[model samples]
Structure formats: C-alpha cells, structure tokens
Target: MASSDDAPRVFQPLPGRTVDRSAAYHALLRELLSLVGAEAPADDEPRWQDRARLAVRKAVKARTVQGPVPEEWFEPMMRATVHEPDPSFVGHLVVPAVAAWGLRPVLLALLDHLDNGTPADVAGVARAWYHTGGAPEAEHEASRDLYRRYQHTALRRFVTLDDLDARRCLLPGLRLQHRSFPPDMHELVDQAVHLARTSDDDYLRHRVEIQTRLT
Candidate 1:
C-alpha cells in the first residue's frame, strides 16, 4: 500500500529542506549496491585485450566522423582483436605524447597546397582539416612516419598530375638537399621563401627570415 510519495523522507538537508525519493531511485540504488558487491579485485596484469580492443573501436569511431581521408585509413588500418588490444599491435606505438595529435589534415593540406602552390587555398583546407580533426590535443598522431610518406606521395602525385598554368609561383626543388636544409626545417624554409618572393613585401620577407631561423 505504501508508494514512494507515501513513504517517509530518508534524507535530511538543511533544517528547512528535506529530500524524498521515488521507487525508481530506490531500484537504481539497489542495482548500484548489487554492482558494487559484484566487483572483484583486479590483477595488475589482468586480461585487458578486450578492453583495449574496445578502446580502439572507440578511437576508430572518433576518427570516422572526421572525413573521407581518415575514414579510408580507419576502415583498413583500424581493426582490433582481443589478443592485441593495443592500437600499436599492428605497427607503430601511439605513445601518450603523440596520442594528442589532430594535425593530420593540416599536414596533408599543407603538402597538397605546396604541390599546387595555392597557399591561401591550402591554408583554408588546413584550418578545415584541423576543425574536423578537433583540437590538436584530442587527436593522436598515430602514424607520423606513415603520415609523412603519405604527404610526400600526395605532393609528388599532385605535381605530376595537376595542371600548372597561369601560376607565377616558382617551384621549389623537391629534394631537401637542393636547399641544403634539414628535413624537418625544409618545408618551413620553402614556404617562407615562396611567401616572401610572391608577396614582394619587405616585412613578410623579414618575417620569413625570422621564422626560418627559429625553425
């Protein structure tokens, strides 16, 4: 005969305020108690393959909402199994530090633009890619080496395939040593050179020089 409203208040707040619960809350509370009771102490090296597989599945889902490029990669490279729960089970390890990299599209767009010499267009794509990729910290830089290779391949393909007419931009040498620069510093130097000469602005030239030194 006693429903939740008919039952006495179990919790007291301030002197003036009291709390009451319904049958659903009580049922949920009972379930929570049962869950706590069901928990057991876990081993330090307990089987986490399933957990890891689930985590990678979650990561793949996160990647899919980005766009086609990543989705293509995800469908093939994103599979997981209980025996190999870690994402790096297939190849390179996604370390804690690099795990927060959402820069794949930026790098891809940048390389794409460099090949096409449409810096403004490339910059816009880079921004969009980053937006879709989410905040840089939220993204994992899983395959850096693979990413660089993809960029290089894309650049080469663009150069070989794309039309280059009515464009006055000078083509930077494909080889890094032609500029006699370190591999990591090469792209910045090249972009700076392009922006400086193309803009014909003394300030931009100076800025490029400054960035080149920093890079």
Candidate 2:
C-alpha cells in the first residue's frame, strides 16, 4: 500500500475496466486496510487474519456487491473520508467518485428487488445476498431500515469487517432500534457477548464484554 500523502493520487477516479475491476478492488482493499496498518497472520499459520484481509480486498472490488450512493454524488464521495460512527477498526473507509457513482446501481438493484417482491421474498433475497441466516421478514425489514438510516457508518463496517460478525453486531442493533425486539440494549449486549465468545478475536470479545457491562 502507498503512503497517506499519496492517497489522493493513488485513488484518483478512472473509468472502471471490466478486466481490471477485480484488481482495482484488491487495490482499494489494500489501500483501505493500510490506513489502519492491519496485518495478516504469519505466512505459516495464516487463517482468520488472511481471510479477513482477503475479504476486505474482495468486498471493495466486488463487482457483485452494490450500494445506494448516487451517481452525481461521485465527486463528493471521492472527497469524503470514512467519518465517525464508521468502525474504528478500519479508519476512514474512503472511495473514489467513480466507485461511489457505481454503487447507485447496486443499491437500486436491492431496492428494486425489495419493492418488486413480497416482503418475504425481499427478506429471502437480502438474506442470501448479505448472507444473513434467513431472518424473518420483520427482522430483515428492521435491519434494512437501520442500514438505510446509518448507511455510511454501516458501509464502513460492512465493507471491511468480516461479513458474518459485522452482521451479527448489526442485527441486534437494528432489532433493538426498530422492531422493539430483544426489549432493549441489554438484550442486544447479551446476544453480542455470546457471538464474541463464538470468535477468537480478543478485541471484539472485550468490546462485547464492555458493552455487556455498560448495558
């Protein structure tokens, strides 16, 4: 990855080529992670770290993945840095204007699917695309609303954080906020704690514990 000073130049917008789209995605992922100095596991035992690294790379460049940013908003997004409420793990999840413009189509696709189908069908499709484990229609709709309301922050996490875990965090927050499910933040924290223990990431575990205590 290049230095921060080179960010503006290294990430200048260009017309995306069909051939290099994947490469560009990898480049974007590497550049994004470089901002946080995230490291992969040692060459010998590389596993989660390596997968996480690759996932980040794949996500940004993923032609299949899409978002709701506007076409005309490209210039603004290029100038935009990942702001607060974005996950602290990956600081400033910035993207070029072209990428932002490209995202509108993707988001439109999702919305189209939602509006075109029944709520149940929308949930099924969103679950498959987002890899959520087939949540109920109401549950998924609540998440969709949360994703809509806090898109930028959610995108930062969605783009970089391991998809499963990020979704785990999001599910509870969304459920609590909209569906009134889980009763309150305490239930959300409890659920998060269980998920943290499901992983080996001490940092996430600590965060869950702290959230548990606070809630």
Candidate 3:
C-alpha cells in the first residue's frame, strides 16, 4: 500500500514560471465554476440564485474530501443568497462582480488543495499571496463604485428611481461622510489593517495603506 509520503503532490510549482501557475489557477476556477453551473452567459443575464444553490451543493460534497474546504470558498455565495424576500440578486450587477472577487481566493486555495493532494489552509495561501504581491489592491473606490452603479443600472430589472437613489447614497465617498461603508469593503479594510499590524514588511505596509485609503 502506498503511504502518505508516497501520495502524489496535487500541485507542483514550476521553477520561474509564475504565468504557468496563474493560467492553471484560472483554468481550475473555470472548471469549478462550471461544475457549480456558475458560468456566465456572454449574451444573456445570469441566474444568480441558481449559481448560489450550485455552489452550496458543491461545497457540501467537497466536505467529503480529506480536509476542510475553506469557508471563503463557499461563504460569499451562501451569504449572497441569504437576503430576505428574494435571496437572489438574479438581476443585480453587483452579484456577479462580488461573486468573482470572493471566488478568486477560494479558487486559488482549491487549486492548492488539489495540487497538494490534501486539505489546504486557505488563510495561509492568502497570506503567501499577499506577501508575494499577488493580490492587487483596488486603486479607487470611487471608480469601483461608479462601475458597479453603471453595471447595476444597465443590467438591473425592475429598477426603480428609489433604487437609484439608494445606490447613490451607498457610494463610497458619500457613505464615508455618513460613516457607513459597505460590509465587504469594511471587512477588507479591517483585514488589511490586521495584516499591516502583524507584518513589518514595508511593501505590505504600503499595500495595506493603499487598500485602506480606498475604503
């Protein structure tokens, strides 16, 4: 019988080949997203609730693997579906963007697990990525907000004038003045602050500053 030591590694790092790893990571993410029926259509609107249900199903099945799947892998999808009344942002433009953002780290962690042939510590993987400058800091919250609003307006169904007003009030700059930031951005800023506090690296500190400034 093959011992644990004899088990093949799920992922092997190629020497001096960052692009190879990135390409592989994206491929695996697409595969997983497809597995959960989350592939977006190029010419049609996506069904966000369907995608969320599929993600929950996949995450549940993944638990049968040897170790824990990272919470980040599945939490956002589940959370997005937890809203009262409609649970789904079926036509909400923000849903897809937020889903993609939340899924990136989850996909990387999943890839690491597959490559390692073992359960992976996603937080450790995230720390490594941040330390290596793999994570891109958002340069401008205003730009992101504007883009999200534009997308929402363009894609949303049954959007009312009240909804537009609500969106305007939720813009980052406006919310900052009211001391009310979006939950996701608040969490990200908190994480960056925590990371900066724990690490002495100058670059990490600068990255944290850039992220926090946007928040």
Instruction: List where candidate 2 sits over 4 angstroms from the true fold.
Output: 1-71, 74-189
Tens digit of per-residue lDDT, candidate 1, span 126-203: 222222222243232443443344335433432343222101111221222214333765564465356445554344
Listed in order, each prediction's TM-score against the native is 0.27, 0.27, 0.20
Candidate 1: where are CA atoms >4 Å away?
1-120, 129-138, 146-199
| Residue lDDT tens for model 2, 101-183 | 33333334434443453333232223222322122344434345433533233323332344443343333222222222323
Task: For residues 85-149, write the lDDT of model 3, one tens digit per residue.
Answer: 12122113222323344434433332333233211121112112211111233322213433233
Instruction: Evaluate candidate 2 by giving its C-alpha RMSD to the native, one decimal.
Output: 16.1
- Residue 92 Cα positional deviation in candidate 3, in Å, after optimal superposition: 33
> Which pairs, if any, clash in model 2?
25-61
Clashing pairs in 3: 10-115, 11-115
Q: lDDT score, residue 123, model 3?
A: 16
| lDDT scores of the candidates, listed in order | 0.30, 0.33, 0.30
